[model samples]
Target: MENFFDQYRDEVQPALKSKLEEFILFGYDSVTEEELWQYLCKKKWKREREAKLLYQIVNDILSVKIGEYMNFATVEAFKSPDWFGNQGKDELSKLL
Candidate 1:
């Protein structure tokens, strides 16, 4: 019944937003978004660099948004905490 964003939005977006905001703002919030982001990422400090970082952050948000409904196929089943159920086992076994 739960959708993709619905599942991960609650889990991923907040953390991503917080990290991105922190990555942009850090301990201080006096500077503008463009200024802070460049200083943090150590980019070219140009208009385009700022714009690119902004774009990447938004794109990361989308990835985190969809990743909520997703599962990590690379992780082994027996090594995973939630692997006791059949949901991850069969899929993982097929990979090995």
Candidate 2:
């Protein structure tokens, strides 16, 4: 079961990563330079990429996709109290 979970995670990581990059770039184009740069740095696309993959892998063991499970993580990452970060939800909301 664990091996199968790991395999599924590997498969989905790239797709999620690509989608996140698109989301970030979309925001970059629409927002001002300072805000865009702040969003980019805070989200740390690579870190978010890895975290999102792990998040999906855990959720996939129960058959959940990114869209189905990303909200909580995004909210949590944003409301960290310790530091500021954007959830990158605007672009996602635009799609929906």
Estimate TM-scores for all models: 0.20, 0.27
Give Cα distance to truth, residue 82, candidate 1, Å: 8.8
Q: Which prediction has the highest lDDT against the true structure?
A: 2
lDDT of 2 by residue, 1-96 (tens): 122233454555554455445545645233232332233334333244343455554343334233333453466558777452255566556678
For model 2, the stretches where C-alpha displacement exceeds 4 angstroms are 1-6, 28-74, 77-96
List clashing residue pairs in candidate 1.
Answer: 8-68
- Per-residue CA lDDT of model 1 for 1-96, tens digit only, reads 332233334344454555455534544333333332323233222234223444554455434322221222122234457744687788888899
Tell me the lDDT of model 2 at 18. 54
Residue-level error in angstroms, candidate 1, position 79: 3.1
Native-to-model Cα distance after best TM-score fit, residue 23 in candidate 1, in Å: 24
| Candidate 1: clashing residue pairs, number | 1
